[model samples]
Target: MHELQALGKQLVELPAKQLVDIPLSEKTRDAIVAARSFKHGAIRRQLQYIGSLMPKEDEDAIRIMLYKLQQPHKDEVRAFHQLEQWRDQLLLGDQDLLNELAIKFENFDRQHIRQLIRNAKKEQEQNKPPKSARLLFKYLTEMQGK
Candidate 1:
């Protein structure tokens, strides 16, 4: 079936270390490893063979494991977007936003944040590199870590 082939393809794409982490049988692992080195038609046939073997294995469990592996990357991207939103809000010269940040971050350096905002705005106007914006992002990230 197409779903089985797709699962086989996913397995082929996984790194060896990740494959090891999954609860695959030794036979399935060996088949996948061998398939990795095959060329063109041989690789396709090997993948189909792996697909045939999938029914005997716990296909749902393998898919769940793959999803778990990808979850952290999604979390990181979401966090980065949140940081960008915060940076943009601060750059918009909203004093209330800064107050909210100060309240949230306790030891937030108000003077440094204001200075970075000014420099970032100047850099944007002059079409220069965003050195100050990067500094601001780094500061915010560090504060979040704490």
Candidate 2:
């Protein structure tokens, strides 16, 4: 019951746009919206009321939706890590990875990638800033859109 009340508090705190994505009954949704306008003890009572209504809901589904809303960038973070790995592999002279990238992206410019790799290598040896590495990552991100 305490957990359900806590989840209700989280629901009430969410913006209307995010709340819309959540599966909620009309009565519960109205209570949450009203709770937003409440003050002091009234909001607590409303949260308890919402909690009482939660047993009729699919709790797991609501939890999953809340997780997705709270961590919207989870997938994007994973993809960014993937791009960084690709950039690192290219810098390491992984020719097979390079060939794989070429086969994957139709607009993959082998010459441009090669040039960026060489510049990145030079920067690493000279202890300079990794300008080319950043550009390579940017290029890879653009390729993702195509």
Candidate 3:
């Protein structure tokens, strides 16, 4: 019963577009939509109502679909973290890693990277804004697409 309420809370948090993808009954969907417009105590009561309605639905299927919907976001976050790690490593003068990146990205421009790194280093030493570092990140993002 509590688990159902928790699932109901998760369902309510989903955007309308995502809610459309989940297989929900009209009544449950209506309840969720209504809950979205409610104030605090009313929303809590609505969630309890939704939880009560959850038992009739296939819990496993809904859970699976929810996981599937969230997976792409998780993957994107992981990739962004990897890019940040790569950027940090490059800034630390990882020549071997830079060489590896050159091989990995066919469009990699070593000279451009060198210029960016030099500018970034100079900016750091001079206490200027990290304009080049941001450009490096933007370049890396484009490189990632290819």
RMSD of each: 2.0, 4.0, 1.0
Clashes by residue pair, model 3: none
lDDT of 1 by residue, 27-97 (tens): 88899999999999999999999988888889879989999987898999999999998998899987998
TM-score for each model: 0.86, 0.68, 0.95
Which number leads on TM-score? 3
Task: Score candidate 1 by TM-score against the native.
Answer: 0.86
Alpha-carbon deviation at 103 in model 1, angstroms: 1.7
Q: What is the lDDT of residue 96 in candidate 2?
A: 100
* Model 2 agreement with the true structure over 1-146: per-residue lDDT tens digits: 99999999999999999999999999888988999999989998999999999888889999999998878678889889999999999999999999999999999999999999999999989999999999999999999878
Worst lDDT 10-window in candidate 3: 81-90
Can you give the lDDT of residue 83 in candidate 2?
96
Where model 1 places Cα greater than 4 Å from the true spot, the runs are: 38-42
lDDT of 2 at 146: 86
lDDT of each: 0.91, 0.93, 0.93
The candidate with the higher lDDT, 1 or 2, is 2
Model 3 residue 77 lDDT? 96
